[model samples]
Target: MSRRSVSTRGVKWPIVSAVGLHGGMDVLELRAEADAILAELVGAPGGSARLREDQWQAVAALVEERRRALVVQRTGWGKSAVYFVATALLRRRGSGPTVIVSPLLALMRNQVEAAARAGIRAHTINSANPEEWESIHEEVERGETDVLLVSPERLNAVDFREQVLPKLAATTGLLVVDEAHCISDWGHDFRPDYRRLRAMLAELPAGVPVLATTATANARVTADVAEQLGTGGGEALVLRGPLDRESLRLGVVRLPDAAHRLGWLAEHLDDLQGSGIVYALTVAAAEEATAFLRQRGFRVASYTGRTENADRLQAEADLQQNRVKALIATSALGMGFDKPDLGFVVHLGSPSSPIAYYQQVGRAGRGVEHADVLLLPGKEDEAIWRYFADTAFPPEARVRETLSALAGAGRPLSVPALEAVVDLRRTRLETMLKVLDVDGAVKRVKGGWISTGEQWVYDSERYAWVARQRAAEQQAMRDYVSTTQCRMEFLRRQLDDEGAVPCGRCDNCAGPWVDSDVSAETLTGAVKELDRPGVEIEPRRMWPTGMPALGIDLKGRISAKEQCSTGRALGRLSDIGWGNRLRPLLAENAPDGPVPDDVLQAAVAVLADWARSPGGWAPDVPDASARPVGVVAVPSVTRPQLVGSLAEGIAAVGRLPFLGTLTYGGPGGAHAARRSNSAQRLRGLFGAFTVSEELAGALARSPGPVLLVDDYTDSGWTLAVAARLLRQAGAQQVLPLVLAAAG
Candidate 1:
């Protein structure tokens, strides 16, 4: 279809009017009206704030023709603007409020604010605002809201899907899917929640125009997303643009190790152009980097999935206002965070894929003329990638097992209940359930999941291809870090950008613009900071819900008297310092041995510091009974020597009795419980450990708290169980102390 530009009311709007029309308004008149609405939405007057040709085409397809469209453009290419403009134009036509399936809270917040600026009222119903959902739903029903933003995860919520979604789908004027690439398993970030959109799309009224947008989709992902958008045989218009950002000056700084990389950031972070992001591979790494940077006098905050919602919002605000030099973060802070003047992005470790890397770096240089994008690849990166790689879709056997369990249950089974029957972890089981739900193999009801009894064939080949893709992407990331070619060109090529060319701004095209040299003093300080270990071990206060259904005798909150007190660990297994020192000692093949002298010394120091701190076990109690009277070791099948030595060493250092080891009753008990869910772990260890007469006498003699030591703590159930036994055996208190915590 061709368009004719038309002028209207002192404003120049692109109007495409057709002769011998298709029973619709003149294309030109529709375009003029859309243009006027776009101008007003962007807070510009007259001819200003005009929509780009591609943007206008997508908008026209959605509004004028009432068609489905997918727009794959780079970050900051105004994808949100296209949807907002369409919402305004469609609302003026007396259509119902636009329903936008946004991917993140940050994105929703940004969209709501941007829509308000454009004079389009919008509200969000997400996990963060459960209290506001009822009122928001009322507003939507009242026809008072212009746009309603709901997270994809909300699409599967029983009440929302059954109650609000049908109404919204039947009456929605326009449907928008932000970060639409997530719909495809082939996409860099495949969210099963997004897959539920297929059902949502199929449920929508035939004429309800749909819009899907993303910045990181490649050829495969683009096709997949476009296909998903084509529900009910509606052809979706795919509008893709070049994926190059000339403003990003890309470079890779190869550091020798985690310390060097951390030290380099600590030394040169301020020298970077402006405040930006420091991405880490894990939550522990983020916290470590944030702590080290703060010690180095740079105001910074840690942002990760673990960060509280309020803290995350504040961290975003801090970065936006330039209060903090950076926010050391995980992938949680990457997508949908809009900061126009973001000046730099530095990775502490390489992500698994170049596409993921490119997407993250896209956060920078969005509005500025130039922004720095540096990758400080670490030796530990590949291991971290491998750790995350386990999240891949499980084998067919496991999928079949889950389906069979649900089918046999005859009723809805919660994820925890499924976990009791399936060997998968909680996260993996939940993800599998979601994928199954999307595939129609299962349904999520109010109670939990019930098998739909659908014949679900596992796409083994597709999963294999995805696994291979992950490996290839990991190798590509390696290539990107070591490539002599232009970094920007390399990233663009990975995204299938045809216009991939050296931008003469990267270190390969030009020369390194950042300083990699770190002073000895700074390096030493970084090492010291990382080596200073002592992370609080917050005990599990409440038992998991629905445990009785899993054949476990546990429910509701664990009584305070029966709980293990908040304790300490030498360090997180993910820590930059002790993590390196502890990994080998705790490896699967690692021989059972005594605690190394250095590690033992460090553990002693941590204990000393913990005992003297203001928040110590008996801070200011002056009860003389504050100190731990004895040290009890949890028996370790794999590391008995290590556990025994650690307890003995602590007792000797603190001049306390060394309570004998807790006895293991079976050949394969807690040792076999690794990687299992809580219910399985609890069952495996219920009476596996016995309080020996010797240890019982030691505990009885020491009515005060006794230090319960273990080689490592994973589920914390082991410690909890041991602590409960010790308490039941007449110990006044149980203080858990572990060498490492698997976070």
Candidate 2:
């Protein structure tokens, strides 16, 4: 049977081909035709307002529901266009007006400009005066306003209650609440005013249909919406899914401090020329960092809540257009914004929480290729967060303030206006808001403002809870800093919400742990050594009194392994399978001087296990020593035969030299990095001579030196592994040329 092939053309190709590669003429014509309408809505709406496949389905759902159906979306995916298109569908119906509750003035203006450009009659209500608002009201009354957007600050006014909601309620219109996740405290953005949204909808007599959308909301937020809006269980059509995008290469880089980290960023940034974002903890730092980077010739922009709307727009536009190579921002850049083709996202410090970090890092790599998200390690990030929490955040006082603010407004007020009236600085207010947001005290709306819910005094309320949680996480971070596990694996575990093991995507998984363990063990003996009665304990441990045994726990001491009284006793007990039988056996059968055969066998097994395990860690044990076992010297990679051989060895394991974010030592591990991710590919490329005498001809000696030279070393794991394998294979001496002994 013959099968038919698909034809390249399927429709009115001329009309359908609106855009294609390289700025095709058809796309330019379509944009020209769309310019007028889009320009008007430019400032009126700010979101990922582009058309998408699922949005088409939503447009169909809204029509099917008769009233607009609610749309709940995750972040980094455009949710704004779902409503824009639904309203466009409304225009075709010519029956109802569409009203949007936006909390950002810049966003409202942006959407308005876009609509005006698109030839759509878009208008905004004025928060400054009733008179100006009446004009917009009149247009809505005439049914000429296809889309009427209002900041919640404007909508919460008594004047608006008496005029606008009544008219909008009576008219056949669609009510869209963008950034709907603000309704719950579980979200990063929360607004108390958004809680009263259902009640306000009830105030509208014609039953204005409600539609909500957000970039992210876990299951609780989704469930809360149904409960809050009386949509009933499953009444709201849920289309939630994983926020993952395959194109994104999510990773974080941690350092001991900010100074060196920033230096590291500057070093690698030469090739990363497209737009990117750097998130800092404070507004000042954001500005300072941007200026510093800019002085260094990086085309950078900075944004915080303090940045003027005009400046913010220009900065965002500059980033989107690649005019600015990078933007130093805070949480201000997280939601309802899109700047495609970003090459990197540099976190000036570690994120306050995994959620914030995940969201911020998720921003990069949205383009066709891989991108980076780096988190500089240290206390600066944590200290700034704590200062405000400890200083101005009296939880109860904040709760009272929020409750009072909510009560005074009577109607819901936008977050910005509330922030304006609050007595504290922006950071304090934000902390209060995050608390209120979590406790369902307020809700968030698109454009970064928040809304309050019901009246409630906050006495050590949200602040206390958030602060406590932050503190616990901070302790975990401290523990991580002091830990001996591979740094990359620890980072991976810290970021995993489900407590999964290291992802192998990190440096630890990539093999850094090998060098750390081996080097550390070499300093401490591999066997336990009993001290003479008055010999004194190891200095690494604090000189605690009691003149106890070496195995006893002592404060201020660090060793190959921590030995607490209880743990030592438990270990001793476990060794004999039980206390009674083991005590007698150890007393009667102490090996007469020479080491026992079983102990020797155990050490061999442990060594074998360490060789095979990922990041294997072993404490110094008693008594087995080696005679500088067969050494295998690795030559410099510049030697074609050596480079080919090394390449051959790495490729044998199906790995490859990954050029981005990973390398093996030599001037930043240049040669080793060259063979990183593509190890497998190179192995195939050198199939004939993989580890052949052609590469090891010099290792023909009885204890040869296998010195592999490279420019730099992050950790000496790669060379160590090669050295170990060659030594095991009977090459005399195995020493890494780059593994310099302790300074």
Candidate 3:
């Protein structure tokens, strides 16, 4: 936003008409507080400041909740508007000043500049000389500044923490965390620093609330975010839902080259109204797309992670105001920004995941107008995509390095100092630490580090990449991309099986592309035990009810915690409705929440199986307590014959969780091999067993002494569909299995 002669940018709404709390609290009161803040700014500050409806609600939530809240909003969800709005409201009520932990220098200054334009008093203390920083500190301490926005590192400074934090914490009505997903390692971008946010908030009194805002969070990403915030297990009231955009039109086009797509875009400029965004997979692509599109007769702008924030912001504004008809950019183009009315999001390459694609596409249609997402799917893009995934997860070494630096410092180091040891050059690391601060790993004060960011011991980027790639591969393995049938029918039916109704808003339903039906036999109906390969799973030692239990405590083996709490697992999954493709479906559907107890049970089972397996692995316990559980060995199969036979006994219970099947194949893989050998010795007593996908996959593909192996839960739809397909394949005796379950 900029101020110029006759511009509305700098103009503020009057007290009588300004925005207010969701309860419709008086805006006049907010204006008065802002006015008071202005009056105390060494002089009458200037114009007026107000917030939009969503901003007002965010402020009220932070002030009243007395706990951290994660706000999953849409693009154009104002980052600064909420804080200033809260400040304005509280100032009117005589509440303390607000402290905003911002991500960038330009963000702070841009906000300051906007406030300056609005005639409000605001400035940055960071990057200033000692004397200047002190001056700003005094202003904040004196409650002269209504809203003091500083980077997490700046706030972590010992000097800032000592003098300003406590004072600010007590009176500060709300602490706002913008782009909140930056806190989680699972996000599109990961920052180790974001892990320390919780301790920072604790510095304040019991009542000061924290506000977390983000544009998007996929299922797993959503969980990771909450975990970082100390509220993952259903403690905080989370507001999560896709920001429904009507004006955005999403389309997928399989294009061969950037030049071709850019040229096509130029030809469609009339439809775009000279206002649109073109997303590239990389900075190089952004630049090329920009140049090529520019030469094609459109004034194109571009930005990447390498672009300076100031210039990027200008490009954003230029694009928004129509100074530029279009912009070519990498994923870095739109964070903490609101350009609501752009007409299109043309992706030069397909995003690694649909969620990323969704978030980027969501940028358009902010005004709820027509917009489009043009994706060019290419396998070649995988390398670049992997680069992002690889980069998103910082190496464990860098994280450990950050921890070592923090441990060495007796007091909070300034932001610049903390980043010195970090190898990554991205400015987001510090900001990410701030995000992680919401999680318990890092500690913080308003001014700065009570503790530096926490260590994510897991190679999250690698793990995360594996999960994404795994999901992608799972889909490919099922071969839906090659399906010639009504894609919508197939996809929607899969979601329905997974409990997701047809959105009807997506391209498959309304787009020009149409698919004719193929044979019903061809579809992956619902994954069934018959389709899956199985394996052997025996208790490491029999339970107390059996010989396995007798062997464990009496002699050689593990502890209780490491042991599978079958009782706990049973209790947790009780509400999971007996499985059949749980993760992604639950992420989108579940009456209680995304992760049902059954799914939790599945997680626990993984540990139990690991315990039973020779490896002494406990799926849930990442640590040593994960010892062997029991030993009552039963061989399973990588193939379905044994599992299919078992399915005949169970009468098809709600579709096998992983592969829904009426009947699965018989003994195959190592499962049968082991059983064959054991059976010969034991005679008829040892035969191949069966399992549900939930049990099979959770227990490393061996379920209830049997195992299954088909590992993709993309939207959870394919699993259900595949299970159905297996059932149709009709080998019978089907069991279930999955290695890792993710949304």
Candidate 4:
């Protein structure tokens, strides 16, 4: 309760070395006081808490010098400790609550608990707790809260930004940006919401110390983030330490294919020290890996963006409490998930970049003395990486189109309305708009987005540079899996870490510490699990809103009468099993050929299984229509022979008649609708499909459902519209069957 809690003259803080021993008496006193406060923050008594030199340097910069600092240290370096100690010291000096712009809910939960241990009253306003927002805001307003954590996305929220942010900026004792690298576009996980931090930084009063910390930033990202932190015109203190984890024993076991990778995990996952994460490249892969692991009797759960918030929370808790062996996860579980004693991190496929891989693996070997880090690189890694690469900064033409649309609208248009005019998908479109908003080209208002009349030029050169850098990083990951150099050094060099050197512990440095062999029995089981095809294709239940504005007749929900029944696909194109085969067969430039015998046989197997499934076919459900009476193909602009042959083969196999194909007459035909958002796609295929007279007569005469066949399904809207046509032509039901699903 001393008035001079933080040393104004940088004096009286407890010293751990001779340098502090030589300081003035006041310096000694200040050091002592700091040591005591650190003890209290760490839930220890009698100055038991100690700070590392780098940690002390950051704390001193913020408390003693009242300066902004960007600490780009590795994870488990006590970045949170520096901020919590600073907040306590500043609060004792009569400063207000520290406002932390955190990036993830998991991180927030951890911070809140950590703060409570230090007797700091911390609360968060995120998507999880709407009911508590009012009470939390009241507490913040009444100065009852010591630390306030808000997600980056909350910065642009209409109410929060307008009402609460300005006040917090004016009076906050400290401004902390956790996971700060997210603010830089050059960073691997750049988020548009993080860009809003620039606005927050601009609004902070002079002399309010700011701290931004991130564990995975490369040198370029570090410099960019430091530059952004200089919003008040003063240079930021950059406390960057060497990126190395002594406890991590890194190794790469290059597996031949998906089955081997899964088999390796099943065989060796339990042997690796403790509970950890099993990273997958895609949601489909994560689910598949989770199922396969469970079948092998490993307790696990799948975590992905598609998982509900409640389920994600439960999964994180499960891992923290060691109730599950691991969380088979996609990138959604990547950043900000903290567990000090996580014992292992195994990747089913190599991440595209060394930096990203380092970030994911850093979660382990944190508190434990020794942890296993393994990379089981797969053949499909590069393709998945390219799929993500395509979503980066849109082309110049697309940018111009967006600006033009906003400028011409004379009013704000929500994302859906914008999609009607722009061809970009919803995610990419929203990302572009956020970037534009941050660049002052547009502004988010009450209704939607509006042009700010700012002349914007697309930075083609910068984006191209980023693209090249991505390609180079991908190559570096490829090298990491195949190289003989120290795995740690290879990753460190990718981050431009000055201390990059051989760790003498990786497989290359230690003669393969991890076993790469998988038992034949395990491999066979894995192959069966993967090769066992058939994924349920859930039909689109509702039409996208605002279709009328785009000159499409569809709106609101599609009555169950016109909707296609829940269908089935052999597999997802992103899956590890049939995905490999389907990728080549469904490639953009793949030849127009008849369905391969293996794939045709697989399709027939799917149908046979579907018929026996409960609630499937005529008598399975009392109210449901009977089994498919005929087969009809949807003409494919790119693969007519494939669709035609598949339909004929299905009819020939099931002993059903082969109805004629649906004619395609729209501009560019079926090929033009290859990639589009729901609204745009609906517009593209609204009138493109029509049932021929012969098919109409066949459907009218048919007493049972028709097996609607297609080469592939992307949006499922094509099947929906086609089903409507068939049902209108008197078909009982339209059971959609496709070769692959576009997840």
Q: Please report, in order, the local distance difference test score of every candidate based on alpha carbons.
A: 0.83, 0.47, 0.47, 0.85
Cand. 2 Cα-lDDT: 0.47
Candidate 3 to truth, TM: 0.51
- TM-score for candidate 2: 0.51
Q: For model 3, how big is the CA root-mean-square deviation?
A: 20.3
Highest-scoring model, lDDT: 4
Looking at model 4, report the run of 10 residues with the lowest lDDT sum. Answer: 1-10
**495: Cα error in model 4, Å:** 1.0
Stronger candidate by lDDT (2 vs 4): 4
What stretches of model 2 exceed 4 Å from their correct place? Answer: 1-53, 67-72, 104-119, 123-138, 204-208, 231-234, 390-743
Which tens-of-lDDT digit does each residue in 312-350 have in candidate 3?
778877876889877777776644444556667777666
TM for every model, in the order presented, reads 0.93, 0.51, 0.51, 0.95
- Provide the clashing-pair count of each candidate structure: 4, 110, 110, 12
Clashing pairs in 1: 15-28, 16-27, 16-28, 17-28
Shift of residue 593 alpha carbon in model 2, Å: 58
Candidate 1's error at 269, in angstroms? 2.0
The stretch of ten residues in a row with the least summed lDDT in candidate 2 is 529-538
Q: What TM-score, to 2 decimals, does candidate 1 have? A: 0.93
Q: What is the lDDT for 470 in model 1? A: 87
